[model samples]
Target: MKQFPFFIILLFISSCQYFEKQIPSEKELLQKELKSINWKEVDEFPSVVDCEKVNDKKLRQQCFFEVMAQLIQEKLDIDTLSILYPELDTIEVKVTIFPNSSMKFEPQFSKDSVAYDTIKIDSILQARLVDFPKVNPAIKRGVPVKTQLILPIIIKAKEEKK
Candidate 1:
């Protein structure tokens, strides 16, 4: 029958749309992927040779921080920061680790810290914080990323004179 053929043709044409894939544009796909990603956290924290062996993610991160703090403490111990500011027992250092595995360190001082000579302290830190161990940059979705952290460094030990 003619009506039967026409109905089949209409059904076939309509069904073709169901099979047709609506391929997304690259930009749309990229935006969708970006939205799904958690920007606040990294897949992997930055690491040094000593921390690479740790299996647990949290432990590895802790190891990296500890190693970094120890290294910084050792480097600054040789400086005369303690003598310059005997009252200053601790200083916060803002460390920025780059994707290229380079690092920068800056002293973080409070706004009310007008009594301390910030410029002199900054210069001393710059002069002292150098020659770090090889550091691997942080990873996010398999890509290396830059990370910033604030580390509290003890400048002077409390002297208990008996």
Candidate 2:
């Protein structure tokens, strides 16, 4: 009968570890969670000055794209877009917005693969890009991240009669 009491005590002591709290500290916990987060996707995408005001997630994304397109078009100086010839219906300007807010400009034709004035286009784009403002980078757990943006500029010579 005495052995029953000792055996119960032994069992209780052996299982005591299971009841102990193993909770990590706040910093440790955050570090652990950060490690598991997928770097490919972010909580918030990169945004410009105007797009930052939007509250909705999906709407913010759309605003970001729209604002970027508008800004690029404005910077292109459509008034003098056709210095060589003013007969073309539209001029396609492809620009890449880097994470650091730097731009890569590629002016090319949509259908016809013709040689372009790379130097002039690069200079114009460089000046415009420098004049433009930097954008807020994408965020993953509040950390800023790099992103890519492509903008296409099309110039129409005249409106078609409808």
Candidate 3:
């Protein structure tokens, strides 16, 4: 019977520690507040790229591929496209449109070394489109708003020498 009270006290101490660690820091609290703002509200559709609304899904997919191609070309600026690996040389970029009037972009590569090499040269862009800039205000939305986007770029790395 005496051990019962000690067990309860131990439980209380452990629970108290857990709650203490869960307390949000000031920065986290502020970020949550900022994210809660009504940034997705829109009176009209956005006017970024030229396309018909009837084929939004199809057109968006094509547009994303086009954008990816453009970014790839930009990356290869002033450089000749060598036959690095005819069988393995390839890149893919994906753009995801969100229901919340936002978009996300991602790039994936078949070769893991390509991803690693990209990070080594430009650590900021392992799966990121360093060429694409932030969407301009005019192209973002018809109404004043804020949105978050993610873009990824994948590149094929050359085989290393022994």
The candidate maximizing lDDT is 1
**2 or 3: which has the higher TM-score?**
2
Q: TM-score of every model?
A: 0.89, 0.61, 0.31
How do all the candidates rank in terms of lDDT, highest first?
A: 1, 2, 3
lDDT of 1 by residue, 97-160 (tens): 9999999999999998898999999999999899999999999999999999989998754343
Q: Is candidate 1 or candidate 3 better by lDDT?
A: 1
What RMSD does model 2 have? 5.3
Worst 10 residues of 3 by lDDT: 77-86
TM-score of 2: 0.61
Q: Write the per-residue lDDT of candidate 2 for residues 26-100, one digit (tens) a residue.
A: 999999988998977879987778887789989998888777767766665544545544554344555554556
Decoy 1 TM-score against native? 0.89
Model 2 off-target regions past 4 Å?
A: 9-35, 79-114, 158-162
TM-score order of candidates, top first: 1, 2, 3
- C-alpha lDDT values of all predictions: 0.91, 0.66, 0.46
Please state the error at residue 145 of candidate 2 in Å: 2.1
Error of 1 at 34 (Å): 1.5
lDDT (tens digit, per residue) of candidate 3 on 50-91: 333435655654564456456654564323222333343444
Counted clashes in each candidate structure: 0, 1, 1
lDDT score, residue 51, model 3?
30
